[model samples]
Target: MTDIVLLGAGGHARSVLAALALSGDRVRGYLAPVASDRLLGIEHLGGDDVLDAFDPEDVAIVVALGSTSSTALRRTLHIDAVSRGFTIATVVHPRAFVDPSVVLPPGVQVLAGSIVNAGARIGEGALINSGAIVEHDSVVGAHAHIAPGAVLAGDVTIGEGAHIGLGSRIVQGVTVGSGGVVGAGAVVITDVPAQTTVVGVPARPIEDKRMRNDA
Candidate 1:
């Protein structure tokens, strides 16, 4: 069994720990700036320094931080792990159903009760949250998050770092650009532009011209 080190300890860590346990993977410990003495029955290894104690070749890491709106912290951790010459593990909950034809890259997280159908190409660092449904021929980009209970119809294209909010649904063939966000419970029927946040039945961009100008 491979020894895995989790990089965070929170509610999401609980779920990831459960998934690792179910898949028969061994978790050596977890870390954070400030964490409980124990999480999910695993030891609370000290912050950043703990990673240096173990050689990358001997142990793998899992960036188990839960990011619903942004990928900043997760992306930072990826770079940190790489700089330390550590390998990040791709984890999939045993309870999730991933079709044989799906292509999953390293660092992908497929949570419990999620279903990723055929012809889907999931990129590195993507997070497919619990109860999400990724239909056939869909493309989920690196660091993208398919929030819990979200549904992507066939042939959908989700760009890198995009966030599909909880319970949202995107119709077939729609392209949600990088950094785009679909509000919770929104029904997206059209293509969403990059860096935009949309909401409502037929999702519309929350476009504030002034806000756009500020950037």
Candidate 2:
């Protein structure tokens, strides 16, 4: 059994908890400085700095926060977990269909109703949100977030820290580069450059800005 300390206490955290339960991993509790004590009956353990309290060698850590239009936050937490010497564990819901040929790295999450087809490689810390569909031969990079109901066709390549918004559709063989964002209900038929934010029906570049300072 792997003992884990989860980070965050929001809705995303709840989803992570569900995934963890499905995976049957041993969860110690959650850590959130600003969150309340009651999180789905699991005690809210304290600040992130309290990671020092546990023996890093014996326990693993998982960031339960979300990736917004910004992927920077997700990357930060993932790096932090690695730095603390905690083995990251990927969480996948029982209801999700991950093909035997799919490769999922540490900290990856495939939520309920999500389907990852054969030959799909989902990288470290990536998230395949509920109802998403990743077709054959697709590669989803590290810390990427494929939002709810998004569809990635065959041979699609989603780069590191990318965010594919809700209900977005990416055509076959398309590449969405690292740190890119495809907004809700968009259709992506072309290559999206790294660190770009695209929106609308056919998904065009909207703006590019540092996530930390923009919000």
Q: For model 1, which pairs clash?
A: none
Q: Residue-pair clashes per candidate, as listed?
A: 0, 0
Model 2: pairs clashing at backbone N, Cα or C within 3 Å: none
Off by over 4 Å in 2: 209-215
Q: lDDT of candidate 1?
A: 0.89
lDDT of 2 by residue, 69-127 (tens): 87777779789878878787778899999999787888888998999999999989999
lDDT of each: 0.89, 0.87
- What are the C-alpha RMSDs, in order, of all predicted structures? 2.2, 2.0
Error of 1 at 117 (Å): 0.5
